[model samples]
Target: MSADRRRILRTTAQLAALTAAGPLLAACGQEAATAGGTAAAAGSGPPHPHASPGTPTVLTPNRIPSATPSSTPGGSASGSPPALPPLAASTPPEVVTGPRDRPQIALTFHGQGDPKLATALLEAAEQHGAQVTVLVVGSWLDQQPQMARRILDGGHELGNHTLSHLDISSMSGDQAYAEIAGCADRLRTLTGSIGRWFRPSAAQYATAEVKAQARRAGYEHCLSYDLDPRDYADPGAEVVQRRILGGIKPGSIVALHMGHQGTVDALPAVLEALQQRGLRAVTASQLCS
Candidate 1:
């Protein structure tokens, strides 16, 4: 071959070698990406489907500050969604109650079923000048995207209740993480933060793996209830009222169901009773903070 032709052949050979090494370099990059991460340390899994672009940034569990209370009913004057407060760290990331020194309690509702019933509950609580927490089910929020804003607009705090309300304790680490993150993504998309708290589904307390997954999903607290009135069983409204009244104490976190009309019926009396006993109702974040 002529000198110029020989040089051209050599350059083409070098180009082929570089092209063959491209995938190898890419593989090294991926390994570097995974090697130092906690999720990779556990075990790699498929990316979460609900994981979407531009999801609000997650707050660090230990460093996130509590949100200032908003005075407006619907949204800020700028019409932006309110930011969620960071949960105070619980070593186990689970809380059954708040400080007993203050005569205040948190009434939290599981968001499910009828949106109208949930609306009624909010309206009723507003009438009593109470602000409670609503731990939203991911699928439920999917059904009613506006409800997330509605909950915040009503001045109630919001928290995660998993993606499908599955029994997260039974899920694998990856599965559990997906459940937590999936719901968190929805919350973050709706509001500017991942809300303040997380609660496990079909159970009161989070398992060890579930707690780790919740931390990964950016929750600092896993809220468990101190008082459950069993209104989900469709027990009579009076019975629900009696159970709530009987069990309530200072700093109690009471769990109720938004799906049940019985809870709707019981709430007016429940609020009246709390007031009569000189106990004020506040959001779970406020109660804990």
Candidate 2:
């Protein structure tokens, strides 16, 4: 594996271990509490679908493998998607993939852009028997509050991307706190919870400050992805499809975008490929659960 891949896998494992040991209680929530008042213990979260023994629910995810799948019977991740339970408080840093032995992957989206496009992608995922996660921008959620319930109704997961979708990693501590909590407030107002996950905006990974803010905002883990097709660049559908299909592996967490037509166009083929490869597309919590 490449250094980047190795680093991702290692970090994910360490974070997961720390969470299981229950050391995640001391982040920013002690420093700056969000208006959403996520006073629940840090690391509390929605239960995972196939989590290991003692793995915390909604704790950030696992490392992915690069190998292809075998033609094993019932490896089809064709799941009877479970209705998402109320998410507990957020957990710590990140989970990039699940156990390597499972033929599962998490398909996560940045929730912004056109709602129609977002709905289309949801339909595609549903039709293909997939469950996904959407880390939404607070402002966008303000624009389309209905999407919160829509996503849940479809058996998907919703998390915070940020309040303003700004360059969150570079912001001052107070600024970052507001960004994380602002979104928490919005999600709480619309969905009755601050969400169980956080992802930094405009960066591939969360900085220490951003993670601290997320922690303070009652998020235990920051969601991260291993596969990015860069669909935001307006690459054609074929390119989007090829990039993801070529790179995806077991327990992979994919970063994709909404509002791009090419990404919308690429969903069908991606779903078909995963099914053919004996892999199932699932939400991050489900993949790590």
Candidate 3:
């Protein structure tokens, strides 16, 4: 062949080789890009849709660390506590009982008076492995600031029972609003969230205006009781225990008081009776939710 022809033949061969290598190189680059994308995704994890900004995500319902007192009331076992759904506007204004078919009961206390009595009540419940809801008066919480944290640390629930334990049903709209909001404010300050329940003072059920005020204060449920043992009447411990055990049924919300020594004394027997009947004593939130 002539020199020019030979050079032309060599050039054509080199061009064919380059064309054959293009797709292979492109495929390799695409594979590397995909692998890098997968690794990046794996490292970052999935987006948390339900997480609140600036708040630690609670994977389980274990007791949150108390903000005061530097100690938990009673240490909790290692397990997921029951989760309570967020309060919604459509939630019932008053819940007198929980699901009737469930063998669960909620024992709620009116929180006021002597702090020592409150502590004793809590200790009694803890001994029986029971969790109760406390409707704390704002003035009482003001008197015993650490008590709010204590209730939470003990794995119990605290709720708003108004500011001064006033008869909110008879108050003006603004006054009722203040009653609810004041307690809510204290709870939020102490726990980073408002309470889960609200109960009207000096009344079994909240009035329409009171319920509206409670909703405005961030409480969706106003707790009422299906069973009232009249523990506040200073009934003897035997009477208190008899009253509770006599009327209690599945899903009953038993109303009691924290200030009564008789109620505290009756707690052990009441808890034992509940166990004998195969009913679990849970917080109001747990039972209702």
Residue-wise lDDT of candidate 1 within 1-289, one digit each (tens)? Answer: 8999999999999999999999999999999887747543442231231223221222232322223434455555343556545544642368889888899999998877787988899999999999999998776665566677777878888999887676677778888888788778777766677887899877888888988999998987799998988888888899999999998999899988886888999999999999999999999888876
| Model 3 misplaced stretches (Cα beyond 4 Å) | 1-70, 73-91
Count of clashes, each model = 0, 14, 0
Q: How well does candidate 3 match the true structure in TM-score terms?
A: 0.72
Candidate 2 overall lDDT versus native: 0.74
Model 3 has an lDDT value of: 0.77
RMSD of each candidate? 11.3, 23.4, 17.7
TM-score for candidate 1: 0.73
**Winner by TM-score:** 1
> By TM-score, is 2 or 3 better?
3
Which candidate model has the greater TM-score, 1 or 2?
A: 1
Tens digits of lDDT, candidate 3, 1-289: 8999999999999999999999999999999999968954643332221112221121111222224542653543322232455543444769988888899999998887688989999989998999999988765665576778678778888888876665677777778887788777767766666778899877889989988888887887889999998887887999999999999999899988887889999999999999999999998877866
TM-score of each: 0.73, 0.69, 0.72
- Model 2: per-residue Cα lDDT over 1-289, one tens digit each: 8999999999999999988766455554545566224534431232221112221112111111112222223232222223444433432356655557799998999888788999899888888999899998776665566677677667788899876666776678788888788777766665556767898887878888888888899998888988998898887999999999999999788999887889989999999999999999988777766
